[model samples]
Target: MSIKIRGSNAYGHSGWFTVYCRICNRKLKIGTDLVYKCPKCEKKYNAYFCEADARGLKWKCPYCNTELVPVI
Candidate 1:
């Protein structure tokens, strides 16, 4: 047998986005992208996946018209 690498470096489900609604805090059943558009206001979001891994991207809440100021 040859001495070679025999492992995998593939991206699995746990390392990717869960694709859910931030406002509703529910997993989306239709969206299929890193960016999710709110059906109600057509607003896109990175989504708050969890407390340890928040994807709280700054963007305007089209529904509420609230400017999500960037935390710079």
Candidate 2:
């Protein structure tokens, strides 16, 4: 499964992009707009802005030691 960003001219932005979780192969609802970064590996991820404070489940990328950021 893979997430794909879609649409055009969304919320004043030039493109209407949506977040899809590749593992789940589903389009994630945009409850909020925010981006996150992993402190360990310096990788970046996107999630709903409202979920920023939620404790993240332990997950890591196979190729890197950095914690995987959750996408809402």
Candidate 3:
């Protein structure tokens, strides 16, 4: 089984990316929507949250207990 990951430059594709809120599964748009990322463990956990979800989480990384940072 092979898992294909879609990411900016994931397959030599540039200038394209999509993010989603881990909590509610809402699609997040950069620049247009406020986003938060967990710096301490984002690489491993892939934690991304939209504004409302981030606030609901108290701006903390649920996995690592690290404070979340704004994407912008």
lDDT scores for all predictions? Answer: 0.41, 0.40, 0.82
Instruction: Quote each prediction's TM-score.
Output: 0.26, 0.35, 0.73
Global lDDT for candidate 3?
A: 0.82
TM-score, structure 1 vs. true: 0.26
Candidate 2 residues lying further than 4 Å off, grouped into runs, are 1-7, 10-15, 32-57, 70-72
Task: Compose the digit string of candidate 3's lDDT tens values, residues 20-52.
Answer: 788898887777788899998777767889999
In terms of lDDT, model 2 sits at 0.40
Screening candidate 3 with a backbone cut-off below 3 angstroms (N, C-alpha, C), the clashing residue pairs are: none
Give the worst 10-residue stretch by lDDT in candidate 2.
Answer: 46-55
- Please name the candidate that would achieve the greatest lDDT relative to the true structure: 3
| Model 3 clash number | 0
Tell me the deviation in Å of residue 61 in model 1: 2.5
What is the C-alpha RMSD, rounded to one decimal, of candidate 2?
A: 10.4
**Weakest 10 consecutive residues of candidate 3 by summed lDDT:** 8-17
When sorted by lDDT, best at the front, the candidate numbers are: 3, 1, 2
Between the candidate structures 2 and 3, which one is better when assessed by TM-score? 3
1-72 in candidate 1: lDDT tens per residue? 856533353444333334555665666433343344433343344532322222453454545555443221
Supply candidate 3's per-residue lDDT for 70: 92
